[model samples]
Target: MTTAERATELRRLHAAPELLQVVNVWDVVSATAVAALPGTRALATAGHSIAATFGYPDGEQIPLHLMLDMVGRIVRAVDVPVSADLDAGFGDAGETVRRAIGQGVAGANIEDQLKPLDEAVAAVSAAVAAADAEGVPFALNARTDAFVRGRDRSLDTNIADAIERGRAFLDAGATSVFVPGMFGEDVVARLVDGIGDRKVTLIGLPGVPAPARLQELGVARLSYGPTTQRVALGALQDLATSLYDGGVLPEGIRPLN
Candidate 1:
């Protein structure tokens, strides 16, 4: 599909009755491996995983060019749509999203990082404007750090803050509002009710409700962040331990790449 077509497909996926489950990939190999799955319809890049691959920390620490370069390679490697985690937009949300569109990214996640409400809304608008200029539907997952960064505050306060920011973001042209921290069913329900059904995205952390349950709760999308990469590394570590313990390479290992 063309870049614009892919972006439109991503938006449609988000609006589908079945929740969109995007497996986070960091590079071409990982992207292709996941995209090869029968159920995979789209991909989301984990900025943290990409940064770690280059020995840098997350939060836009990886140089913008390097991040975009890797994301571009992943885009070229897979036929499915890709939604990149362009964390905090690398200090220039508009320009970063424009370049990501140029790389053929169908969507992106831009975190507010608890910035002032007005500034955060502006960032969302800027990103949307850039995508509009590029003529792509660009699923901009505007993220609010209220829950993640407001740990010291009361749950009610954080939820309220998230709902407020989420509404503002949606009004400013975000495709969905990503609330990243873990929460119970009640909290999720409140968010869905407050933010509008099927307009909230979530992360799939350990112990979170199953995707089916989350879909029932009206979530639009669910993405595994750096956990996917961490899980792969954990398997590698287990293999190394077995090898050191006199075990031969396991049989039936398929070359995904």
Candidate 2:
């Protein structure tokens, strides 16, 4: 399928009856590994994982050019649709979103963590316009940091604010409303109910409800944001530790081919 076709498919997955489980990847190897899975419908990049793999910090600390290069490689390596966590659209929302579309990404997670509400809405609006110009139905997952940044405030306020931001983003043409740092079923359900029309996405945080439960709560999408990468890195650390402690590698560790 063409890039635009895949983009449309990705958008459909978000609104499908079943939950869209997205396993985030960092490089070509990881992308290929996940794409090899029989049930994998799409691929997504974890911003922190991509940054740390290149020895940089997350939160847009990685250079835009370098990030785009890596994402381009991943998109080329897989036939499945690829989405990237383009943190804050890498400074220029419209231009960077266009760059991602050029790389053939089906979707992206654009965060509004540090920017004001109006600016964030404008950014998402710009991304949708850019995608239209490119003739791709880019799945713009507009992420709100209300729950993460509003810990000091009351829970009710955080949930309310998230719904408000999500409504604004959806009105601005976002494909979905991504509310990270929200794990509770009640809050998740509330957000889903409040953010009408568009699909709702939640981060796959540890100890959160199972996929079935999340689906019951009306979450259309769930993504492991950096958790999979951190776990993989931990495994690498363990392998190195075992090698240092003993001369032999683990019994199950062997070449795939």
Candidate 3:
């Protein structure tokens, strides 16, 4: 497709009525699979996925240049719109959002993580402004870490904080509010309901529930967040072990790599 066509598709996707089952792809190969899926309307990349793939940790271990290069590869390998997890925006929010748009991503998941909630909001707001300045219809997934954080706050307190942070972030021009690490059904429902038709999303980790279950929970979108790479690596390890220890290929076996 032409550049204008691609941009139009990416911007129009957020308006989709059906819940988007966005998988976290780490490389060109997985991005290709996700792009080929009939149900896949967009692609999301994980920060931890880039860290693990590059033999680093998740705390911004992979630099922006490297991550942007990998993102470019995946974008080139797929036709769908891509939204990347730019963990903590890797710096201030404005530069983070601008750099991501510079790399051709349609959107980014900016979290109120590792810093005061106010700073996170400021950062995301700056990012949104930057993206807008560039004439890109940037979608910012405002993520709160009240539950995801290892703080000693009670669930009630954390929920309150998350809701408060969610409201502030949304007011700061966030395209959507994403409450990651809220895994419980009841908790998910509360967050989704709290956001209330403002295009909220949740991180639906694998083994949490069936996709139908998430859809039933009023979730507008779901992101896997790099579990697919771990799954694939484990499967590849087992396949190699079968070739080494089993001493024979199983029936109808073919190359996994």
Candidate 4:
């Protein structure tokens, strides 16, 4: 599909009745491996994973060009739509997303990083406006770090902040508001009710509710962030340990790439 069509398809997936589950991938091999799965509908790039793969720390430490280069390669490697994690937009949300659209990325996650409400909303608007200028129905998963960044604050405060930021982001034209962090069913329900049904996205962490329960609670999407990459690396580490202990290669390993 063309980039625009992919963008539209991504939006449709978010609005679909079934909750969208996007496996986060960092490079061409990982992206292709996940995309080959029968149930995979789309892919979301994990900025932290990509940064770690490139020997850099997270939080836009990796050069924007390098991240986009990898993201573009992944886009070319798979037919499914890709939603890149363009961390905090690398300082210029609008231009960053504009460049990503040029890379054929259909969607992206831009974190507010707990910036001031007005500033965060402006960033969301800028990203959406940039996508509009490019004529792509880009899915902007506007993220608020209220829960992640506001750990010292009370849960009530964080939830209120998230709902406020989420509504503002939606008004500014974001496709969905990503509230990353673990939460109980009650918290999830409150967020969905406050932010509008099927308008909230979440990260699927170890203790998070199951996808079925999240779907029943009205989450639009669930994405596994750096955990997926960490799991893959953990397997490699175990294999290395086994090899050192004189273990032979495992049988029936299929070539995915």
TM-score of each: 0.99, 0.96, 0.90, 0.99
Candidate 2: what lDDT? 0.88
Tally clashes: model 4.
Answer: 0
TM-score of 3: 0.90
Q: Which model, 3 or 4, shows the larger TM-score?
A: 4
Q: Is candidate 1 or candidate 2 better by TM-score?
A: 1
TM value for model 2: 0.96
Residue 166 displacement in candidate 3 (angstroms):
1.0
Off by over 4 Å in 2: 254-257
lDDT of 3 by residue, 1-257 (tens): 54335545654665466667788998887788768879878899988998788888887888888988898788778878888888887777788778777777888888787467768778878987898798777777888777788468788787777878888888888777787774577777777677656366777664455667767776667887877788889987988898888556568854423
User: Candidate order by lDDT, highest to lowest?
Assistant: 4, 1, 2, 3
RMSD after CA superposition, every candidate:
0.7, 1.5, 2.3, 0.6
Tell how far residue 219 is off in model 4, in angstroms: 0.4
Sort by TM-score, best first. 4, 1, 2, 3
Each prediction's whole-model lDDT (CA): 0.95, 0.88, 0.77, 0.96
lDDT of 2 by residue, 63-102 (tens): 9999999999999999999989999888788899899999
Candidate 1 structure quality by residue, lDDT tens digits, 1-257: 99999999999999889999999999989999999999999999999999999999988888999999999999999999999999998888999999999999999999999999999999999999999999999999999999999999999999999999999999999999999998888899999999988999999986668999999999999999999999999999999999999999989999885
Count of residue pairs whose backbone atoms collide, per candidate: 0, 0, 0, 0
Stretches of candidate 4 exceeding 4 Å from the true structure: none
> Model 3: how far is 66 from its true place, Å?
0.4
